[model samples]
Target: MRIELEYNARSIPPADVARSFVPPTPHFGRLLSRNHTLLLGPRGSGKTTLLKMLTARALNSWTHPEAAALTPQVTFNAAFVAADIAWGKQIEAVGSFDFNASRKDAAFVLHTLRAIVHAMREATELAREGRLTPHAKHLAIEITESQEEKLVALVAPNLSVRPALPSLLGLELALEARLDTINSGEDVAPFTVESFPSKISLLISAFNGVTGDSDRRWALLFDELEIAPTRVKTFLLSGIRSFDERIIVKLALAPYMDDAGFERNPISPHPLHDYHTIQLSYPNKDDARNFGEELFARTFERIGVDAPSLDLLFQPPEGGSQLGRRGNQKRQGVPEEFVSLAQKDTSFAQYVTERNLLSPDYRFNENNIAQDIRKVLPIVVARNYYLRRFDGTHAVANRSRKSHGLYAGYPSIVEITEGNPRAILTCVGPMAQDYRQDIERADGFVQVSRSIQTKAIRRVELLLTSLLQVVPLDLGGFDAGKGLLGFVDTIGRAFEDRLLSRPFTTDYVSTFLIDENVSDAVVKAVGMALNAGAIIHVPYPDGGPDTLLRGLRGQRFRLSYALAARYRLLLTLGDRISLSTLLLVMRGVDVGDDQRALF
Candidate 1:
């Protein structure tokens, strides 16, 4: 009856490891040409995760001979440099190291510097080992005098003639590094380092030989790329390109880079343009439905129970009509009940299943959608309004959403990059986590579990946002609630005038004035968000939807305090709210009522 889900990073499978949600680009093998393949996607579209997995797979242990012939494996160690930058400072000092050199001990100093550089880069060691083990807990031995002797002996022949002695021990590192305090936060002093670039070249050369068979000459992953200052970004990009041609680098950028003032980082002969750009799109509606269902089933397993996979749900009948209905005699009502859930469940899975509730053969039109809301009654009606409130950018019906918001700025676009089902699910985990955080930030929310939660004002908003985002052509109006009614004509007018800036367009955005010419399919979807109590609509006891037009600009396009106050009046005015909170009473006052007048 109830389920709980957890985000398990370890369980996430790699996209390149032979999976369905993602496919090796027809041209992925040639990703490392002077022109880099730049993959860009919205948050949770699996861009970063895919990169890590892709790089790993590209360096597979079982090297295919044909693959090797097509593109040579450029073995390189990967490290999250940007992530290091974000961990604050002491860690930043981790990148700093000592390269001491007394003139008499020049050879000895050279070896110590090399060893320290190795130690400084131990972050990649963890990634190399795949997982930590007891053996890796500590470096068994430090650079003793003997080991230093061996290092010097290995390169003795390469040293400059005695007449021209070098001041720095390891000439390679000397060029890029300098010893200085790293500004660590502890009262203790910061670690010093040799800031030379040549040392890295030598180290990468050594690593390339060790893992000669791998794809990335040196796989370096940079997560949280946007957090660094533009200057730092510019510098790092230059560093990777200049010193390491054999190495492959991957960067995890912020979700908003699509809006990343391109003008700021003008695309000229910039190095980043070389990467093959890719954007992560939300899973298709079919994939989303499966992902959601799988998550639900997994949660059930965590609690020591097992149920059907998402595939078990009855498919939406091919036509535009009701596919899953309880009253139908063809199959069990269990499927119908499973497909539809109570609107207020705020958990990640909420009250959703794979069943198709629309009756077969009927054309899906706006009024039909409205009728669906009416049929599902007050529970679905109120929640739909809430779903549209939170996320308004993407279309809501049968589609996956990458970035969500209802601001009327952009048209709905669905472009999917991942083809593997598991990878898609893996990508979604983070986005879902963001939604969960949003729920927590909302006023008076009570997260019951992973799949379910008690709805409050904010949860109601979440419900509405989800609905409005996916369902297109859905606009309506509600005057201060003389009754829970639709503003069909008004929604038509406002939309035609381009009044809805999306999620915040109108308190009764769902009911905004619209022309009757709007598509029926879009209307149906909006009705769903509306029925789910995802939007806020308040019709005056004596007012029409037009009253909302009085407020303009910033004041008009925000959570309506008047509507909230009015909705507040409706809930408390009624009979007791239910176990799962429900708005059963319509907004209005009783006439000719006594002091004991009840809603």
Candidate 2:
């Protein structure tokens, strides 16, 4: 048997999305409320999936346990208007024909209105066919022919192009025809157009008139608003502050709003006041593991049988011989090399002695080591694996080496995926196939080996690095030879260098804070990196205010653990440093084409 999960929500049909939906904590319930929202996340952070699942079609199709009681709470009729690449192109092209800024904004709003009408039409058809859930059926608009004509007459009068008839299709056709004229770049005269708020109010009134649910609200779910025109984005931002009472505006955009009128900062809409902002960026360590484990278990549950616990499937690599080859010798609990390091390196020996794992004789009792080092076992394994002989001494460490069972197991996989659903699916999909094949050959569940897990993680790293390399970044004036990839690699290798440095100290530099006096081009690169998920913003861990980046200065960011394998860095946050120091080192080295993306 084989199980497959869709990585991209846009490609999934509306019904399928509801069927496979896993409600992201806090965001889903908050989104279901009547408050206006700005859902900010990077690409593939389940933004599209969440927005689409709010529609009537998906709500009716939902069979999840919470659907029974929760679906009815979605009182507003939702319209999923996708401001995707095609819509962006059409809206921007209107300006190519010398359309005024207001005209471009009007066109964007018109298209948005058309999409709402389309959603209503689809819901009405579903209700008429008896395919909608009871709550959704009541939410559907049942417009009579007379009411449709009245709607067109009231709404289409402000349009430069009027509808041929008084029906829904006619209104849509009129909008389409007008869009086509704009797209053609043909000469035309200036004409009257309705304001965005006015048009939206008219539609809501028309919807209420038909549905006979005057008290019910309407949600305009706009996906990918970052791709919309600048004027339109500004208009929408204003709408977030003040909009129609019956209209709920939910805008989806990237975390970095460099293009959305905040050239020096990310989009920072005041949370809880202007609009409720739901961040779907990389979660913290504990949250990531819990959510990722849900996805992991759900993947196995698709096989139609009781699944083993996640730990049973991808067991953590044990220390010593379990992690690496030890010839044909009897397996000891701890590595002999670790014992040797304690004998040779006084610092390492003293560090162990402090923990009581080492005796006064500078020898480790294998039995006592296991019981004593249980808490710091991972650190022990990492230090042993990465520590190397330099200048006839083991004081200084080597640059990271091949995996002695690093970046494996469930916890590591969760960290690598960084709470992104698309990333989780991409990493687990191949392993699930392997699990299926393994079960068919054997009777019981087979543990996915560390090599397999490492391979999956490495594949994701390559794909991400390759994407950053190909996508052009507007560095403005800063020339770093290799564009975004070079910027990311320079930081990544620097972190790796820190991880492997010193007298075996655990407190190494991993995260970085952007210096206040850096060039604008560097700040732009950081913004682009945040937008692309190459680096993630690290909020203060002590429940401080979740503020957006006004500028990169003093803001802390860590490279995505998705690139951790490529640099052999740990799957944890460490001490921070100024980014300027790292850039200074990069500037000192003559980085050329050969030095691009060291992975």
Candidate 3:
């Protein structure tokens, strides 16, 4: 029952590495025009995650039993086309982004492109591995001093043999040769900056030669392509235009004005076409809340019923010393302020994102301080809050200016996930890497000055509490028979828990990188809610971090979408919220144990 969730690193390799994932479902036709469509989005959006998911799906589709039975021809191969970006200080625009850093990293870009072609070819060949000769079915790259030389080796002799070209210019030559082979005698018109479609027809013909079909679909993934020059953009657009039916080129757009075309009319075609776009939006409160629930649900399913997820983090010894680990707590009553009905479950386990999360098991005995067992959830929350905060602080901390500019924003559930479920995992991921140097400078972060430790701890607290606070909240409503569900309190309680349970405000900015103003704003917002009686605090009878019961009578407008298993109202602070209160109106289940089955 070892429940281990392993993700393909290449698929969702941290967004920092290759942020070019676009979901491939609908966005078809116009958006998903090509199998190789470029995903365009602002920086920090989950492009990488989406890519990883796409790759994972591709990989799974190749091997998964159900997928294999249905879609037999789809191949799954993914690679990271990294941006060897040139840093620019004076740029303030997004649409017309120039990624060409003064520094030269085009070599890495060239290598990445070659790898993309080879990797896709390998995936295509995998469907008939033993049955066919590898080189005969898929094209393999021959690295030479010149890309033209390499192209000549792999391509037909008749294809225009342009040699020794630097960088992506090789791709341009290949396109020309491909068209020249098929349209040799045709009176071809010259490529114009604005008339891009004719160029696409030529490219399409080239692809038709390779796939031997006019409608063969191809997708080209471009990560961090904005660094290329405008002329290059026009040229590449033209090259791809020669093959619109055969390819969809996807690329990342730097989140600045330059990336957006300088005031293109809404109704008109974007100067950059062939890309079907899926824009990432800033997460709203509801979005954040739903995302948490989604994490929980996915994790639970992944954890399954066998291996206890909690044990993954903190397993007790075989001769367990702690008594009643499975049942209700001791005689000491749960706090009166906590929600009451959420007590005594099958286990002390939390399923998060396909992982039954628990603290990493330390020393068997409590005596070993180095191996002290701790709650995995709280620590995960704490670390997330810390790193997100840190991301904020490092982004704008201009120490040389004598003023570390306004720590403008704190993390809004800055969830740093590496497809793993513990602080130990994140300690090794992008979130923790930023601060690793500081920790290394002093053996460990804690060993550093108190100021650093405090700031780090504060961020960890903020993020942790934010995550723990909400679920698919009962956004108030009523059932066919049940009277009301206090949707507001349900949400309010969730939010309150997020704030109170995690670390409050702190002065240290460098640690979690929390914005001073944003941190304080959240605190003030929580306080204002409490002061207004808009958020009421209830006692938990069971002493759990989150009590389950909701109020009896509440705003009844929200019942339509609320699911039964999770929706319950606490009714009143004075009343003992329980299953009995729920049983009165809950129609699906009968009062007695021998209730009739629901259809």
Task: Provide the lDDT at 74 for model 1.
Answer: 28
What lDDT does the true structure give each of the candidates? 0.31, 0.68, 0.30
The TM-score values for the models, in the order shown, are 0.37, 0.84, 0.35
Give the count of colliding residue pairs in each prediction.
Answer: 121, 0, 69
lDDT of 3 by residue, 271-309 (tens): 335333453321122323333323323343444422123
TM-score (C-alpha, index-matched) for candidate 2: 0.84
Worst 10 residues of 3 by lDDT: 556-565
Least well predicted 10-residue stretch by lDDT in candidate 1:
406-415
Tens digit of per-residue lDDT, candidate 1, span 231-265:
44444444444545654556555323211212223
Residue pairs with clashing backbones, model 2: none
Tell me the tens digit of each residue's lDDT in model 2 across 1-599.
46666678877878788887877776788889888888877777889999998888898888877777677778788888877543464545554355565555555766777778777777666766777676556556566767667767776765555788777788888877776665456433332233667767777776677667777688899888878766667667654656788889998887766555332233435557656778787535565666677777776666443455775677565542222223223444445655765664556677666765434553445545444443334444555565654223234545345553567775676678887787777787777676667667887656777777777787677657776876576654333455688778878877766544445554557788877646666777787787778888887675222354245567888988888777777666677887877665545644332333211
Worst 10 residues of 2 by lDDT: 320-329
Q: RMSD to the native, candidate 2? A: 6.0
